[model samples]
Every structure is written in structure tokens, then in C-alpha cells.
Target: MAPSATAVPATAVPATGTLLRLATAGSVDDGKSTLVGRLLHDTKSVLSDQLAAVERVSRERGLTAADLALLTDGLRAEREQGITIDVAYRYFATARRSFVLADCPGHVQYTRNTVTGSSTADVVVLLVDARKGVLEQTRRHLAVTALLRVPHVVVAVNKIDLVDFSQEVFERVNAEVQQVARELGVEEATAIPVSALDGDNVAERSTRTSWYAGPTLLELLEEIPPSDDPAHEAFRMPVQLVIRPQGAARDEAHRDYRGYAGQVASGVVRLGDEVVVLPSGTRSTVTGIDLGERSLDEAFAPQSVTLRLADEVDISRGDVIAAAADAPVPTQDLEAVVCWLGDAPLRPGQRYLLKHGSRTVQTAVRTINGSLDLDDLHAVPSEALSLNDIGLVSLRLASPVPVEDYATSRRGGSFLLIDAHDGRTVAAGMVGATLPTAADAPTTPEGDEAWDI
Candidate 1:
């Protein structure tokens, strides 16, 4: 297969600048699709053919004007129902910056889809209707965004035109949004009034609201710096494959070549840098870095490159290689906050497969601490977590695995629990504060007995 234009050499960095991954989230009918469409249209990212297609669809549906929301609502079911049901990813670029937008669903039923889309986003764009103010769904989105640790957030108060572009309405909504952000510990949030349907204050400053003065959403996005700190944190690479060219024709350099291949989960690794393989506590030095047919002097987080080691230490999938000083401690027990995704409630003693980065291992829920009450923002003691419920739980792994705190390192802290029988993801988990040993805490009858599944 031929490489696409977007594909670049492993060592090549764009001379112009960096790329940003952003996600759009909001409640149902909050104008998420329209906001995305307006941004693309006002930025001149949409082509004539696309515009014509939208117009044709609008006409067929007997709409008065071209429905810009059709641009992001790609699914036929979504178009027919006038609701976004799934996550739609769109890409567009300007001279100053490039963007990958994940348009997440706003419906409460699709929370899992939202989590999946925003998991890797650097910034989250949350849309709130100007007239409706902050709703339950708005708070839910904010909570999820904070939980995911998205570095930046932009709250676009959409449909300002319907509100007569009133400064008072905008101010009221903005104030409420600010209050919510403060409560959620989101320090970096920008609020802007926008008329998505009219394309105001999205890609360009709006003339309708002359009293307001703020950078356009596009302007703000282009100005924010891309996060590359993970590349410098600490070297971590989860081995995915062991590569060896085995053939009678292979000779010399090819015959001696043995590489551990996977994308760097975090930090920088250079040739000759000493590293340790986790779980086994094996140590080795990086002899070389290989990308396709070319050799590289170094590789950083997120870049997929094969590594040549100085020693022939046993390594395989599910094993992590990292800088010795920064290597995470291996453990069989873990505490975490899990968002249950399965139809069945999560019960203690129920075994599942845990997938962290490229590693997968058998795991079981040792205890269910409590479930979080979204409306009250508090934990309620519970024995099991039901579908769509978020709760704190403890897990015991069949084998030791290296992991870090979720707050400290997202790459190492986040994991997915999947059903071993069907390979379906059942929950999204974030490593929580570790619990003390039984001896550290005074024993009680309730705590002493094992939970019944």
C-alpha cells in the first residue's frame, strides 16, 4: 500500500508548527454539529462539492436553508432523526495550524462514545445554548472533561443570534459557566458567544456583538500551544512485537537484527540510553532505533519505532521498557474509578481482562468502594456499579504490571476493562488513591468478609 500525503518520515517535523487534537461535546440540541459546521465553513475548509451536497440534502428534506449541521452529522440515522448518535471525526487545516476534531455525541446514552472520543484530546470545546443557560447535560460534559484531564476547555455559548446577540444574556451564561468551571477545578476555560448558524464569533469576530471583545474560537485554538511534555516525562515503551527477519537469504546486518517494536507511550529514548524492562527487572541499552527502512538516532513519546537493544533480554508483548530511574513500580493490586460500560452491573469476584496501553492481562474486582452520584457530586456506598455508573473500585491482577498515578501520568494511569469472553470493553478506569494494607486499617466485620458477587 502507498503512503498517504499526511504520512511523514519518523524524523521529519513540520517547519510551520504543531498539530492540535480537539473534541467537541455538549448536551443534545446544544448546537454541537452547527458549531463544527460553522467553524469549517467560516474557515473556508469546506469545498464547493461539500456545500452542494449539504444544499441538496437540505432541499430533499424540505428545509428552508442549507442545514449546516448536516456536515458533521454523517450518519443517515442521525440525519433522519436530527440528532447526533455517534462520534464523527473531521480533519481540516489552516496556514497557521492543523486540527483533528472529534465531534462527540451529546446524548446521555452515548457517554461511552464521548469518553472514547475525548480520551486523547488536548482541548475540549463544550457548547452551551445561550438561552437555556447551563443544563444537567452541560454539567455532565464538564465533569467528564475534567475527569479525562483535557488540558484546555473552550465554552462556546451558541445561538446568540436567537437571543438578539444580547450582551446581558451572554454575560449571564458566561458567569454561570465560569462558576461551574471553578467548581470543577478547570482553571483554563474560555467563554465565547457564538451564532453557529450565522457563523458569528466562531472563525471571525462577530459584528453583531460590538460590545463584546474577545478572540475568536479559531484564533484562540491556533494560539494555544500543543502539549509535548509527555515526550520529555520519562522513557516508557510497551513492547508490542519482537521482530526478527528469519530466512536463508538474510545475512550480515539483517541476520543479527532483533528489534522490539511499539510506539513510545511516553518520554524520549536515544541510542545507547540505558533502559529497564519492567516486571522482569531486566536491564539493557538502546543500540539503535528503526522506522521502516531508515535508522533514527532518537525517538520520543507517541512515535512508533522499533528498538535494537545491546543485550538479548527476554521481552514480549505486555512488557514495558523504560528508563530505570523513572520506571514505575510493578504491582498486582490497583485502585481506580471506573465508568461501567456493560449492561450488567460490575460485581466483586467477577474476572475481566485489563488492557493498559499495549498490554493486556487478566484482572478481577477485589472490592467496590462506592459509586459517584453525578447530581450531588458525592460518593454513595455501594456493593456493585450498574451500567453507566461511575464508581471507585479495587482490582487484583493475575500478573504484576507497571503503572503510575492517573493524575500524574495519563499514559500510564488509564486502563480499560474488557470482557474476556466477548472482548468487549466493559469499563474505563482511572487509577485512584491506593488503599492501605489490612493491618494498617482497623478491621471490622463488614470489611473482613469477602464481598459476594
Candidate 2:
């Protein structure tokens, strides 16, 4: 594959400075936290004071070696129980790139949290114990990674030291996971063997494993380019707020300061570019863009900026501004693949609040399609969805919303199902609506009816 404008060649990895978001997923006791700790520790990203605290805590527990997982187990309950309970994020940087690492819990019950972390991840580090090989939870993680459409996957066979760093053992485990990944339509993946506890083949190449020849975990992260650059894609921005200046004096600047504020959802917006206000079908031209007081000729995705249009079109929060020539059709009835995380079973006619980006709409489940059967890695017929169930469900929204296929635009294609009664998020939904056909392949309807899986 060729590198993009900002992507660097493999040899020039350290020369290109970019921010990468990564997440870790595996079964319980797979040492996800420890691997993360190793990355931070070996890279010299950890601070002296923080290291001292971890060491002190380890001594109090009378452990021979410091429990590196203590660095990420922030919650008191997690520390007491020696497990991660929520999504813990850590920021670190090396000479090559900056990173935002989400250390997600591995328990099957915490699968929802893993989805949240991997939803926007550029690379997912999936760990499997060498001794245990691939477990049910490991396959479940692979399924979620495939569903999220993560650009890169690293199947790190951890605890290799416990397995005597046997090359045959590593090969068997890697081959098994690779076969399952291919069955899920994941064509590309990287597998590495490491012992996060011993820091072997994690940040540094291990001498213990002379047979394996591949980039270390840290090297792989540095070399893989970011999934997508927002400027190179379709322009999109969901209006978060409307800025209409209200002041004590009605001056020239104050009277004409009508702008929309939002983070660039994707693509780039330049002055005089024609854009359409979605859901309302209002067309306008970008007259001005400002990052605080600085005037900008163009603004790209991820940058928060205020935009003033040439026409006084009626726009509000939740409205999507997209390129005039290409815009998604606003629809009220939609189908999505959702991972249910509520105590109450998801049934037809169940009402909930659907939050997509800045927009929130009242929604009800119209049909409970089928849940994915992890045993067979297939979607099976089901009438209802309980906790941690991944299924296809149709929704009837109160109003129209602009949506893109999950595979097309991550920012525009993901949503949350919030419980209206308790204001709690019960599910995370991906905008693609797919089903298995008789041909043994995932398919969507033709024309505008199709949404990618």
C-alpha cells in the first residue's frame, strides 16, 4: 500500500509525527494492563513519582515484583479486586508518534466497554495466553474487532515465557486466530508472541524467541499508518452550537457574528466552498472560518472552528453540514447492528433515546433481528437481546437524521442507545445493517438501501 500525504515510509517511521489511538482487548488475566504498562515503562513515558507510588504499593502487598497493572487500575474497586472495571485511558508519546491508549476490560460482561474503546481505535492489540491458546472470550474479542472495522489488528500471544517461548506453540495459536479472523472478513492482521510480564518482545525484540522474526509490538504501532486522514475524506461536521453574539452594545462586529461551531467531522472546508445543511436541505457558501480570532482559509476535520456562511440558512444543533454535491439522505427509519448492554431485555416496541454525535432522538425498537452466535461465528435468529448481545435491530426515530455507513465514516456512523428513564447508556450501535445470505457471505440491500457491515 502506498503512503498518504502525511504517512511516512516504514524506514522513516520516527520522522513522521502523528497521533495514534490504540486499544487492548483480551480475556480476563490476559495481562492487557501489564502490556500497556510495559509500553509506557519501556518508552520512558512513565514519571518517577508515579513509578515510586507503584513500587511502594507493591512492597506493601509483599510481592516479589511490582504489579505493573497497578499503573492502570485507577478505580479503588479495581485495585481491591485486582481487575479493570471500566475503560482506562493513558496518554504517552515516543520520538515517532503520540498515543492515546485505551486499556479496556477483558471480562465478557465488560464487552460493551471494549466496543467503546475500539470504536475509534486505529489499531487493536488482542492478547491471548499462550498456555490457554484461543478461548471463547478471545474469539468474542476478534468478532468485535471485525465489527468495528478496525484498520489494523495485532494478535499478541502473551505469556509466551510461561510456554517456554516455544515457536510451535506460538505458531499453533496464531494460525487458529488467523483462520477465525479471515472467516469474519478480516483479511489483514499481524500476530506477535510476547510476555508482557517479562517485557519480552513487547517494546524490545526478545533474544529468547530467535525463530520469530517480526516487528515488536511497539515497532508495529509506529510503522502502521493512521486509518484515515479526515482532510482526504468527504466533508462533514455536525453542528454542536450556533453562535449569535448578544452584547451590551450593538456594534458592527457584534451584529454580524452569526457562526456555527463544530469539530470537523471529516474532510476539509475552505472559504467559498458550497455546503448543504442536512435534514433541512438549506444550501450555503462558507464565507468565513475562524479558530478563535485567527482567520483561516481552510479548516480540516478534528479542528474545532466557527464557520460563517454567505446565506442566512436556518441551521441548528444536530444538523449536519456536508459538501453540497454529495450528501447522505436524511432518514427516520433505520437499521443498525447494536450491542445491547442493558439489564432489561431488548424487545420489539421498546423505546429508548438514540444519541448520534450531538443529536439525540426518541427511538423505539421495531424488530429484534438476530444475535451473533459466538460458537459458530454466525448471526442466529433471535426474538430478543439481553446483556452483551450483538444483534441486528431496526429503529423508528422520531425525526430524520443524516447517517453514513459505519465502514464509510466512523464519526457519522456510530451511536449510543441511552435509557430515557435513567439516562444510562444501554447499547452502542454501528450504522451498518448487514445479514448473512444463502451464499455464505454478508450482504446488504442494493441502491441507497445498502449499508456496509
Candidate 3:
């Protein structure tokens, strides 16, 4: 591999610097771990003792070069089986920015882990083997990335060296990937040619790829902006617990105190700010904000604080405090897109618990609109959804909930469906998205029939 390249000494990037969170996904044996390992090594993020251990293991296995994949496959099972079984996270920093990288498993059975890893990611890096081009797993991963609405996507065409660095092959694979990305409604995705086994185009560009004219993987990662600032959004905070000093052991000054405690989900809350309590439509003015034992005039998103209101409103856990003018409306009927993760098939009329924010309610699937076909990315009619299936469904809730459109607020718009029988997570859902109409569905030669699974 390009061992001749000089290594750059790792410098401590300040914690106050901008942070970027990214996740990696690809089919098994596509060299995802190798790509990650290459980046870590080229950037000098690995400790000397760790590299020595990997080198010793490589020699014992009768290899010429140290197996870089061993760097991220930390589990005992992963080392023995030479496969990733769970999500592996690594934190490192460059002078420009700090990073939190998640190397997710590639097996189909581990799709849930991929979802969990990518749920809050600002960018998702998907790899494709230059020889295999795009496989079914690639399409599946792309669909998941699009559904989650990750801010940025980068596709790395790995193992370009295997094809002798053919420009034609790279172009063909890039075209196919772009086409699939467009079908899935991904606004933009950049494809870069790289050889993860070597260090080419990963941390540093390779001379072998003369035809390619794109930024290297690390460069692109550092350039993409992080997720939007939470303070700029509308104010929202789900009440986790009601705080009221009780009992004789309490201090006399706090004996009559009543405050709502929760983490500010978005935007800012300040003293004298007019706020509304959801589902009850009760309005009150913020009188005080307390963090720990210290009182503050204002608190912003992601900060944990206790709020004292001007009025004695009857608020409880699962209730949301929001800005008075931009508060969400409560509704019982919801149209959503879901990725079914249960072992059992998902069918209409199935009863489950819907957990939205801090609240939970009984919900039923009124209709199974359709499933997205990976072959053509169309919404084909489906009576049921199997494990790892992405589909559109309508739900009827027992009580109204204040939810914003998923496009507007990820925290307020997303929810989870739980199996009531055994407390298993069945699906992840996004609200305020329309179900595909029958007219919008693609037709076969026989005309208007469901696509076969």
C-alpha cells in the first residue's frame, strides 16, 4: 500500500472547534473497515502499541502487510471471525474540525444498527466495491440514508486498484450510483475513486487516478458543514419530570417552588418569554430559569434547566413547552413513512405503542399504503412489511399529539413503534410525509399489479 507517503503528526484539535458526526456503510468485504483504518493510520490517530499489536497479529496470520482492518474490529468475535458484528465508534480531530465517526456493520441482519448509527449523523459515507459496482445492499443502504434525511452523502468507490485504476469503470459505477441516488430523492451525492487497501484518495490523493478530479475523502469530510444550530429553531422542551421541593428536609426558601425540568430540545428559553403547554393549550410566561443550583436569565437548546412559570399550570411528564406563536397543532391522524424492523411482518390493524418525544400512546395501523421498491425506487402496493422494509402507512392514535413536520424538526417529527407483547421496537417512523397515491405507482405490462417481493 502507499507506505512511502510521509505520515503527518497528529495534533490535538480543540474541543471547542466545530464537530462533525459521520457514519460509514457498505456491503460485507467492500473494505469499509479498511477505509476507516487507512484514514486513522494516515492521520496518525492510532497509538504505537496498537499498531505493533496489529503487526504482530498480521505476522502470525502469514500476511505481508499489517492488516489495517484489525484497527476497528475490536471485538473478540470480530477478530476471530474477521467481520464486524456491532457499531464501532472512534473519535479524532484534525486542525480544522473534530469528528465522531461510527463504523457500522454491513450484514443485512444488522440493518437496525445502521439505522441507529445514522439516525443523528450529519453525513453518511457509503462505500462500493469497484469490481461489484453497486449491489442490493448498496441500494438498501442508500434508501435508509435518504429516509433519515442525512444532511450530506459521500460515496467512495473502493478498490479502484483492483480494476487497474480504469477511468471507464469508475465513471460507470459513479453514473449508476448517481442514478439510484436521484431516484431515492437524494438531492446531491459526491462520488470519489479510492483504494482503501492502499492509502490512495483516502487521506491523500494518488497519482494513479489522473482522470479523477475531486477532493479526497478526508478533505470532503472536513469541508461539509455540520447540522443546523439548535438555538436558531423554535423553542421546544418535553417535560421529563415536575420539580417541587417536598418534605421537611427541604430548605425553607424552596418549600413553595414549582418548576418543570427537561432538556431544551430546540431554540432558547428566557425569562419573561411567553410559552404554551402542548395538548392543553395553556399559556404562561417564564419567570425563572435554573441550571443546577444557579439561576440564569436564559437557556438554549441541549441545555438542561428547570423553568418556573408565572401561572400555576397543570403540566406533567410527556407534556411539551413551546413558543406561544409557533406551537405545533395536535392531531390524532398521522400519515408517515416507516422502516419496519420487527421479525414478524407488519400488517394493517396491528396494535402497538407509539412513543413520540417523551409521551407514549396506543396506535393502530389504519392502512399499509405501499413499500418502496429498491429496483426502481417506486412505491408498490404491499399488504405487509417484513423486517428491514421501508414503507408508507397511515396511523390512528388514541390521543392527539403535537408533532411538527419531519422536514421542519427531526426531534419533534420522529417516533418509534413498540410491540406491546414483549416491548420490542417494531419500527421507526417520520410524520407529516404523504403516502404515495395509486396513480403515482408504477405499472407493469399486465397493468397495476403489486411488485413481487
Candidate 4:
């Protein structure tokens, strides 16, 4: 039998069978946007009018060829400035895999935007210009990716066409990147040579790089496994609202209705499961689960459902409900790495709103440990964290709140610090291990005074 054009390879699986969430990082004008545009175009994800519009714009700008970068640089400011200022999300699919790509800005000032986009990503794609080799921005991006602990990393050596498709240049760049990856404990880094402007080795294999024997970028993305961590964690549901409808039909069927509504953050929750609500530590058994009008026997991670308890227990927003045996303990003091996003520096003793999961509470910076020096990937002791700076700090919450270590659980360990005055998000934080008390520590400071929250 002969193979058909639409026939799937023996190794190929359905694209919808798995979904991959990835983020792209690079220096400005390093072809991050162009690479994304090339991927989408080659995959036939762009509409005819969209392609025509891009071509027309390319002509208006007096370019000899279409500007593929315009596909994702959608903001008017981004277009005018020719630099990405905000995180832009693009979706596309191949026969073998579906993807949600977060195209992050490359400007150093937009580091906060990069963090926001890559926080939930399972994999990160770091693009480097073949001509420039590895620059300072490239190293900084790698440092951020390592700090975030993205499970997978791919280093794409872009603009191979401009380098005349030299294999030696590609090998040199790959070796340098590998060294950085090794230092960061990223063991599974893959480097591929490609030309995003010319559509080589992006979606389809490039014939120009005959010396390279690696999978194309798209092929690699499809073959990489999806993250199963969220499904394996203990069930967690942060109550977003209480479902209650009152009207003439609110008699009989609706009269005895009381349910906690929220989206499942992780794991599986089934009917009759014993759960504990944090802060209050109230215990209850799941009597029923409702998804809109239909009742479900079980609900898993990422599902939105309303749960009814066997006994009426006090539950409200900002409370996290989880399996009693696996519930996290609430704590008042939290140690974390924060990415300061505000123009003003983050000062110790400043009050802010700490938002985690569905819970939001008044919190203050107890101490500033240090800020990251991206160029050298070292922690420099600092009294305050500035805009676009990453730092370690201690947070003192007004009350205890459930939080898991970031190393153990990303979803439970992450939070956002919002300025109380204007309600603007000031920093992104990841909970770290708690510091030992004086009695539990090997040493104690002299003339120690209790720190103020």
C-alpha cells in the first residue's frame, strides 16, 4: 500500500491529544517575533486577509519582503516603537501537536512582562541571533528560565541564512549555550540552527543545513512530553464565589442549595472525598459536584465546578479547600523571590496586598535579602528591589495563609504583590523554604531586635 498525503506517520499522533504551553525569550530584534510568525505561517495558521495585510504593511514600510514579525506585534505602540512591550499570546496547531505560545518582550525594561508570560509555561524557547552569537541578554534570559525552573529549554540559533549556513558558527554558539545550561542545572537543553526570516528549520526541515541532523523546532515541540505535575498534586480548589440563585423557582429544589464554586487548581476531587478548608480548618465531605446543570462523579485539575458539602461549614473566597491529608499548613511568614515591576523600588516595611490563588491579604515586606545581578547570575545584597529587578525578600502576612514551597508545587507557591493604594501589581513572588528560628539555628545575631512587619 502507498502512503497518502494526509496519512500520519507511525510515530505521529493526533495534535489535539496533547497540549504544550511554551514561552519564547530573546533580545530585541533577535527575531523572536519573526520566528513565531514563521511558525504560524508555515503551519497554515494565519488567515488569508491577515497574510495580505502583513504584506501590504511590509510594502508600506518599503521592505522588499513581508514583515512576519508584524503578525504578533499587534499593539499600536509596539508597531510604532518596533519593540515588544507586552506579552503577546498566539495559538496554533499541527497534525501532531497543539501549542499555546507566549511571545515575551526582549527589552530589559520588560523583564516583568517576561516573568508574567513564562510563569505558567512548561517549556521555554530561547532564541539567539547567529550573527551576534551569545550576548548579555541571552545569558540573562537563561538565568530567568533557570530560576523559573521550566522543565524544558530549547536554544534556537536563528538567522542561519545570514551566516551563510555555516556549521562551525552553529557549533560554536551551541557549545556556549550548553555551558550556561549546565551551570544552571538544565540537563535537557537542545540547540537547533534555523532562519526564521527564510522559514528554514522552523516548521519544516531545512535543506540548507545539511550538516545538522536534529529535529526541526516544530518536530521537537510535538515530541516533548506534556507536564503531568498538576494532575499528580493533591486536590486544591480555591473558592472564587458562592453559587446561590434566588427567585420564584428558588423553592424546593433550590431551597436546600448551598455550594462553593471555584476552579480546581490541581489533582482530582470526587464525591465523598474528605476536604479541609484553610484558615478556618473546617472539615467537610463532598456530597455533590455540579458543572452547570449536570452533576459529575469526579472533577480533576483545571475544571470549574460547584461543590456541595455534607455539612454546612463556613467557606468563602480567599479560602483554599483540599484533601484533608494533603492540605498545606497556613503560615504568616513567607520567604520568596520577587520580581519587582513597579517604577518605585520595593522598600522594606512597605505594605501591599499579597494575592495567592484566590486569597488576597494585607502583607508587608519584612526584609530584603538580595537582588539578582543578571549579568553574572549572582545575588547582590540590597536594601531594596528596583523595577525589573529580581530579589529575595520575606513577607509578613496579616494572617496565616496556605502556601506550598515552589520546589514542591508551583501553583501553590506563586503569588503577586499589589500596591494597596492604587491596586497595581508591584511584584511577582515565589515562596521559598522558611528560615530557621534562633533556637533551631546554629548561630544567633547579637543585639537582635524583632523585625517589624
Which candidate's lDDT is highest? 3
**Model 2 lDDT per residue over 1-453, tens place:** 011122222233343389899999999999999898787777766666777687789899998676779889999999999998899998777788888899999998898899989988999999999999888888888888887888899989999999899999999999988988887777788999999988888888999999989999999999989887878888999999999877665488678778999999899999999999999989999999999989999999889999999988899999989998888888888888888888889887778899988899898787666778877777877778888888888888888899889888877888999999999999988887563321343332223322211
Evaluated at residue 334, the lDDT of candidate 2 is 80
Candidate 3 error regions (>4 Å): 1-13, 434-453
The sequence of per-residue lDDT tens digits that candidate 4 reaches over residues 1-453 is 011123232223335758899999978788999898887777767776787788899999999788889989999999898888899998888877788899999998888888888888988999999989777778777867776778899999999999999999999999988887776557778999999988888978888999999999999999999876586899999999987778885888799899899999999999999999998999999999999999999998899999999988888898998999979999999988787889899877778999999999988777777676655555666777788777778778888999999878889989999988899999988898321111122211122133344
Least lDDT summed over 10 consecutive residues: which range in candidate 2? 1-10
Overall lDDT per candidate, in order of appearance: 0.82, 0.84, 0.86, 0.83
* Cα lDDT tens digits for candidate 1, 1-453: 011122222123233457899999888898999888776766556666777788789899888677889989989999889998899887776668888899989888887888888889999999999989988878777877877788999999998999999999999999988887776667878988888887788887888899878898999999988865788788999999999888874678698788999989899999989999988999999999999999999999889999999999999988999998778999888888787888888887788999997888888788787775666555666778887677778888878889888888888999999999899999988886322121232211234234322
Q: How does candidate 2 fare on TM-score?
A: 0.92
Q: What TM-score, computed on C-alpha atoms, does each candidate reach? A: 0.90, 0.92, 0.92, 0.91
RMSD of each: 5.5, 6.5, 4.7, 5.0
lDDT of 3 by residue, 33-69 (tens): 8988888887777777778788899999999898899
Off by over 4 Å in 1: 1-16, 433-453
Q: How many angstroms is residue 300 displaced in model 4 relative to the true structure, after the best TM-score fit? A: 0.6
Q: How accurate is candidate 4 locally (lDDT)?
A: 0.83
Q: In model 1, what is the error at residue 84, expressed in angstroms?
A: 1.2
**Candidate 2, overall lDDT?**
0.84
lDDT of 3 at 163: 97
